[model samples]
Target chain A: MRAEHIKIGTSPPISFEVGSGECLAIDGPSGSGKTRLLRALADLDPFSGRVFFDGAEQSEMPGPAWRGAVRFVAAEPVWWTDTAREALPPDEACRSRAVRVAAAIGLPAAALDQPLQQLSTGERHRLSLARALADNPKVLLLDEPTSGLDPAAVALVEELIRYRLLSGNTVVLASHDAAFSKRLANARIALGKKPLTAHAP
Target chain B: MSYVALTYWDLVLASLLLLINGAISFGFRLNLERSLAISAVRMVLQLALIAVLLKFIFASDAFWPTLLFAMLMLAATGYEVASHQSRRISGWRGYALAGGPPFAAGLVTALFAVTAIIGAEPWYAPRFFLPILGMIVGNALAGAGLVLDTIADGANRERQVIETRLALGQSRFVAMSDIMRRSVRAGMLPIMSMMATAGIVAIPGMMTGQILAGAEPGDAAKYQIMILFLIAGATGLAVLSAACGSVLLMTDERHRLRLERLQSNGSP
Candidate 1:
């Protein structure tokens, strides 16, 4: 996946590329357009630039198709449905994969059947990540994936993401966790500074 | 029994009942006296003007005049629908979006009823065509307005929920399915309740009017049933179309939520 001269909300034009099995970390302060950049990459926001996935342009494919391949997981995700299981994709394969991801993320399989209102904030956040991972997209745009997790759960999430990377998926994440970013990202970019810089870790 | 004419003195006597409301407003210091008086006067004038206009249309009984009047009524309905929106689409497009579906649905349904069902001598006969169009348009105006309001407000309130679905690769229609369903239900609620309680809870206005005009009770009831069915059909179509139209306006071809298209009416 690659973006060329992408501009979001008065931020400097951002350009970056990540290959298969690679992770790119976007580190910035609060209100620094990290989430906005991810949204643009997911094609969920209107941004000026060209994004290419596997040699096809973002605009070339339909929005849903592109987003399905390159999914965006918000820091605080939203669930429209009532139960945790209902929030995952309704297909059989996705549901099974979601169960596995849930278990791996330290969420019990029974938690999937519980109503969303009963779940804690951290539980909901983990469930949201599990839901995105179940889709197994080519690229994952994760915004602050480890913000609400305890050290144990955060380690588990790191392991899950590493497994995803081993299986040849690319990831671009924005986070304030310096240790997490250093461990995961091969290349990094910092926003909010003039003339943004991208460099290898 | 023949239809009894209402004299001006009878209207004066009946209007005296409004004083009860005025007295209540006064006693409570509700500050509603001015609005109540203006509303009462406005109602009287509007109804009186409509009666005179209907008399003129009935005397002429021509197709063009009837069509012209129907179009005018539809335009007014469109304005009313647009005005009901708390988060209105900015420009003339707002009016078009609010009014277009109901106008098409109401006009088509009324014309079908007049030409095919009633089989009036001249299909566009002002008396039959105008009344049928008025009822359908009136009901459709309410329905379409409700639908627009619900959809616009829901879109604003559920921005995160909807955008999350979009981010999950759901199509715009799929992302909007819940709100669309709710809006359509809201639009149809009034008509549904009216249908449920039509004969037992209260005699419907059309039936009552027909009975007072010396028609047989059975015939009046039959006509009422037909009108009710027409209203249900028209309102359903209007609401469904309004939902679809609103969804189109709220999103783009890229399936991004374009909430910026909606301008807030500045109310909390």
Candidate 2:
């Protein structure tokens, strides 16, 4: 995944590239455009720049197809429907993989059938990541993915990120955890209030 | 058949009924007296003027003047539609969104009824054309207004849910399909209820007018049914067009939910 001169909202223009199988972390304080940056990468927000995945420009592909390839997991995830299962796209492969990943995240298979209102903040966070991963996207954009998780849950999620990295999936993650960035990301960028600067990996 | 017209004395006695209603409102402290009085006055004046002008129009047999009057009525209805919305969409967007569909749909349906359904001699004759056109335009205006109000409320209430769908790779059409369906249904509800209760529970105004004009009861019933069908058709077309057009205005070419395009006062 690659972003060339990507400027989102009022933040400064940023340019970066992550090779296949690489993990990049966006580190910033609150209200520093971390969420906006991730949203721009996912094509969920209007931005002035170009994004390319696997030699295909985002504008070249249809919006649905492009979004499917590069999925976004919001910070405060919104589950529009009543159940976790309904929030997922109806693809046989994605459904099977989602069930497996739910179990891997320490959730039972029955969790998918449970009502969304029953899930705690931590559970909702995990389910949001699982929903995005279900599609097996080429580039996964995550904003504060482990914000509300327990230590054990955080470790489990980090392990899942490692697994995806090993499988050659490109990931762009936003968080305020410097240690977490060192632990998972090979490239790092810290965004400030007025401007942003990319740090060497 | 000849019918007796109400004399000036009969009309004077009818004014007593309005005075009685106004007195009742005042005694009850219902706060409706002022509005009731104002509306009564406006109704008398407007209807009197229309009756006089319509007689002249029917005698003149000129197409342009009649068409011009119909357009004036359509413009007023559109203005009323926009004003009724709680979240006002102003400027040309407001006018086009609220007015365009009803005008187009009502005109087409009215023309079809006069020419094909009734086969009125000289289809543009003001006597038949204006009345039928009034009925279609009035119903369609209300339906289209309901559609616009529903969409405005839905857009405000369902912002996050809609954005979720859009972000999940759903097309703009697919993302808003549920809300659009609900809005169209809501717009059609009043007409549907009227249709359901037409004969048994209530007598519609058109039928009452025809009867009062000395038409045969059976023939008046037939004409009422025809007008009711035309209203349903025109409202359907108007509501459909209004919902679809408003939805398009809320999104962009990138399939992003452009909620910013929606006017908001920054409250939840």
Candidate 3:
């Protein structure tokens, strides 16, 4: 599956591709359309382009099925629910997995019952990650997933990403953090620079 | 209206509350003077006009004019809600789509609860019709208005989040269900607050009006309870209808929020 043309706002346009099961990390300066690319691919942005997933038409498939595979988690997630328990799926298996994910990410077990307003920024971000991971998507996209986290939290998120990648998920993480990107990315895609750098070969 | 019952101290307290309101605006250095004055002027002028219109309109036995007036009021209420939420809601049709379901549902609820339940005279008498319709329209306005603002802002701000869910195989309505519930809950706060107050905060306008018009306080209080229940019912229906209608209206086959139409302030 890939995106073509991909214009957003009045900014210069960019396009790219994602082969099956290959984890790609979008690395560039802030406001470099990394999130935009993900949004466009997710069919969330208003763009003039073609996007396809696994030879099936993105526009042709039911939105639910298309979205079921393609998921994007924003840097600053807006939660619809106030409680952590309400945020995750009600299914026992998914709920227990979310609890495990939250604990691995350094969130307290009590966070599940606490109101969202009570959680710190890092905890909230972890909750967002846990929610996305619960959906168990084929395409797990993250926008600066560890940008605001402390060093320990960042390492934990990296561990989670690595775990997902090991599970054969197609992971695309967008970040400007070089050291973090190098550690987890199988291929790096950069944006918003004068000359293109293709080093994945 | 006994001066003995309403003492000079009661007058003093009401004035003191108004004075405190004015003082807080000044004390906090909040610059609300221009809008405050304008709002006060508009309130006075509008109420004076309504008083004059109601004097003659209430006395008339003819139902056609009253019905026309009620319909126009409902349309106005709906228009206010739409215009307040988005400038892109171009014309009557755009407003109608946003406004129609809530108004119809609210009116039906109000009619059933009032005539069937309260047993008002002449069935559609203007006295009952105007006040009952006014209450319905007023609450419906608040509920519809809340839905409009929330949905418009929600569709834009949470567009990506919503789209993410849809891409992940969540149906459009399923994606919005949580957000819709939250928005409607926020909308119903005012109604809930009013219900909490009732007689203790001074009788509501409907009951107060009936009392002044020579009805016994006990009789008016029963009617007030009925009106409150109907108004609450109408608001619930209006809010739910608006939320569901707006979501359906704004979604296409791809399940994307129709931003083009709203951004242009026109229907997609």
Candidate 4:
């Protein structure tokens, strides 16, 4: 995934490219367009720059198709339906995979059958990531993936990100955890910092 | 059987009913007497003017006047639909989105009724075309208004939820498909309720009017059935058109939900 000269709201022009199997951490202060940037890259937010996946412009492709390949898991995850399963994809295979992913994310498989209102905030957050991964996206846009998780759960989420990277999927993670970014990301870009530079590739 | 027409004296007697209601309202201090008087005045004046206009229209053999009148009614209805929305789509976009559906549906259904059903000598005959078109346009206009209002409000309220679906690689159509169904269903509810309750709880106005105008009970029933069918058809078409239009207006070619495009003028 490559985003070039992307400007959203009051943020400065930002650009970066992470190759297949790579993880790029977007670090920023609060209100520094971290969420907005990820959304722009995913084509979920309006922005003024170009985004490309494997040399193909995001705008040139159908939005849904582009979005399918570049999945975005929002920080405050939204569930429109009652059941957790309904919030995921409708296919049976995806449902089973979601159950597996939910378990892997430290959520019980029974979580999928539970009503949305019954799920904890941590569960909702993890479930959103699980739902995004169910599609096997080429590029995953995660906003604050482990914000509300316990230390153990955060470690598990980081492990999952590493696992995703090992399997040749690209990830753009927006996080305030600089230590975690350094531990996992191949490169890091900080918004609201003067002379923003892409770290060692 | 011949029907008796109400005379000026009968109208005077009808005024007594309103006076009685006003007296009761005033005695009870219900604060409704002023509104009741105003409503009565408007209804009498508007109906009187419409009757005069209809007389002129019915006497005319030209089709242009009839078409113009239909357009006028459609425009008024479009304004009503747009005005009723909580998040208004301003300017011509609002007018087009609100008015276009009901007009097209009403006109098409009216045409179908005149040509296929009624088989009038001249398809645009004032007597046949005016009343049938009025009924169709009126009902379709109300349905379209409800549909537009429901959809606009729904889209605004469900912004995050829809964007989440859109980000999940669901097409705008697929992402908001459920809401669209819900909005259209809500829009059609009144018509559905009226249809369900027709003849059991209420005799529809058109049927009652037909029966009072010396038409046979069976003939009135038949006409009512046809009108009901036309109304249902028109409402469906209008709701479908408005739903599509509202969805299109709410999104861009890139299939993003542009909620910013939905501006408000402080009127819901």
Candidate 5:
């Protein structure tokens, strides 16, 4: 996946490229357009410049098709359905994969059957990550993917992401967790009040 | 028996009843007297003007004049529908989105009713066509405005949920289907309730007017029922179309949620 001179909202033009099995950490303080940058990459927000996935331009494919291959999981999770199970894509394979990811991320199987409104903030966040991972897109844009998780759950999330990386899926994430970034990200970009900079870790 | 004509003095006497509302406002210090008086005056002037215009159209009894009057009413209905929206698309697009569906639906429904059902001698006769078009279009305007309002407000409130679905690769239509369904339901609810309770809860205005004008009760009841059905049909079509149009306007071909396109009334 690659973006060249992408400008989102009032932010400066950003450009980056990540190969298969690589993780790009977008390091930035709060309110530094980290989420906006992630949104641009996902094509959820309008941005200038070109994005290419596997030699296919973002605009060349339909929005949903492009998004399906490059999925985005927001920091603050949102559920449109009543129960966790219903919130999955309503397909057999996705549901089964969601269950597997849920168990791996320390979420009980019973939690999937319970009403999402009854879940804790951290639990909902984990479910959202599980939902994204179940799709198993070529590229994942995660914004604050582990903000409210416990240390144990956070470790489990890291493990799951590491597994994804091993399987050759690219990831771009924004995180305040320095240790988490250090552990996962092979390349990094820093966005702040100062001009943006990118470097290999 | 022929209908009795009301004198000017009779209308003046009837309007005197508004003083009771003015009295209540004064007694409670509600400060509503000014608005109430202005509304009363405006209603009287508007209705009197319409009465004169209708008399002229009926006297002329020509197709072009009647068609022109119907078009004028439709334009006015469109304006009213757009004005009622809280958060509307800006410029001519806002008015077109609010008014276009209802105009098309209402015209089609009224034409079908007049030509096929009622069998009016001249399909565009002022007597039958004008009144049927007026009622259908009026009800459709209400329904379209309501559905547009609900969809706009719902989109704003559920931005995150909608964006999540979009990010999950759901098409824009699929992402917004739930809200569109709810908004269509909201728009249709009023007509459904009215149809359900028409004869039992209250005598409908058209039926009451027909009875006062000395039409047989049975015939008046039949016309009222037919009119109610036409209203329901037109309202349903208008609302469904309005929801689809609103969803299209709210999102783009790129399938991005463009909430910035909507602006609250009275804001820059």
Candidate 6:
């Protein structure tokens, strides 16, 4: 997955590329554009740039088709359905894949039967990841997927990301958690709360 | 039911309540003090002017002045409703889209209910149409205003979610499906529920008024039922119209919420 010079607000555009099946972790403090960068690649945030999904450019394909192929998990992903079971894709293979993902992320199997409102924030985050995994996406964009989790939960999420990478899913994760970044990222990009300073004197 | 006259005490009590509300609102946040004062003055002036004009309207043999007054009221109310709601759209186009459908539906529905449904003798008579249209227009205005505000607020606040959909390759309409459902539901649910529970909860205003005027209970009930149907129809049309208005703002013919038009409030 590649995003070339994504522009937001008035910030000088920055671009980065991640090799297929590799993991690139982005870390920044609150208000930094880490999430924004994920969104731009996902096409949620408007920017003047290019995004490449495999060899195909995002510009050529229909936006919905593009979105389906490249999945994004929000920091606090909004669940529209009643329960975890309802959130998964309709395919049987997808459903089983989601179950495995959930288990690896430390979500109990019974969580699927419960209403979304019953899940804790960490549980909800994992459920979102489970949904993304079920879709069989080529590239996964995750935003603060482990921010609200405890150490054990974070470890589980790390394990799940590692598993996805091993299975040949390209990953782009945005977070402020240094511990998670150090463990997960093949390459690290440090960003600032505000645009980096440049001077003309 | 107890009969209460519009006596001096009633007027005093209403005024006192309004004043108390103002005082409390001011105490908590004086951010709107100047605007509030201007609104208070406008209300006093407008009502005072209307009271003075009513005497001349009723006493005069000619009906043109009275009709003219009603038209002015309709236009003012329509403008206020449209302008207040479509701040994001922010122009005459917004005003037209916001006010046009509701006004049309409310006017037509009000006429149908007042004339054919309730069997009023002179359907076009301003005396009947004016008051009934006021109520219909008021509801339409509220309904349109509610839907637009909800949709815009929903889009702006949950921008990340919306943008995520857009990015993932959903066209504007496809992407907005979940949000559209939520916004419309939030706006329209109350009106529908009120209609469902009308007589059981409390006698509606029109029915109670007709009963007070010594109309037969059956006739009053019929009239109230007609009003309910008209309101429901107007609200339904309003929901459709508000959605149509918003569709233009968000997307091109392809039905994509234009990336530029979608403001990012907390998107990052």
Task: Judging by lDDT against the true structure, name the best candidate.
Answer: 1
Report the lDDT tens digits of candidate 1 across residue range B1-268: 9999889999999999999999999999998999999999999999999999899989998888898888888788878888767987878889898888888888889889988899998988999988988898899879989999999999999999999999988999999999999999999999999899999999999999999999999999999999999999999999999999999899999999999999876663
CAPRI-style quality class for the chain A–B interface of candidate 4 = medium
For model 1, the docking class works out as: medium
TM-score of 3: 0.68
Which stretches in model 3 have alpha-carbon errors above 4 Å? A9-16, A77-86, A96-128, A145-167, A177-190, A193-201, B1-66, B82-102, B113-115, B118-127, B143-183, B193-196, B243-268
Alpha carbon lDDT at B210, candidate 1: 92
B225 in model 6: Cα distance from truth in Å? 3.2
The DockQ for candidate 1, computed on C-alphas, is 0.76
Tens digits of per-residue lDDT, candidate 6, B57-111, equal 6556355875686677657755776656534465566666667767777778877
Backbone clash pairs for candidate 1 read none
Residues A1-201, candidate 3, lDDT per residue (tens digit)?
Answer: 576766754446656676656678887676667787787777665568777777887778776677778887888876666787886766788788878888888887788788889888888888888877776777877888986699999999888888877787788888767788888877876676434447743
**Local accuracy of candidate 1 as per-residue lDDT tens digits, A104-170:** 9899999888998899888999999888877778999999999888999999999999999999999
Highest-scoring model, TM-score: 5
Descending-TM-score candidate ranking = 5, 1, 4, 2, 3, 6
Residue-by-residue lDDT tens digits, candidate 3, B72-139: 77678767667666533445656885668567866797678658876767777776777777877787
lDDT of 5 by residue, A46-139 (tens): 8788899999999888999999999889999999998888878878888889999999999998999889888999999999988886777889
Q: Order of all candidates by DockQ, from best down to worst?
A: 5, 1, 4, 2, 3, 6
Per-prediction RMSD in angstroms? 4.1, 4.6, 7.9, 4.7, 3.9, 7.4
Kindly give the stretch of ten consecutive residues in candidate 2 chain B with the minimal lDDT sum. Answer: B259-268
Better of 2 and 5 by DockQ: 5
Model 1 has an lDDT value of 0.90
Q: Once superposed on the true structure, which residue ranges of model 5 sit more than 4 Å away at CA?
A: A9-11, A194-201
Against the true chain A, what TM-score does chain A of candidate 4 give?
0.91
Candidates, ranked, lDDT: 1, 5, 4, 2, 3, 6
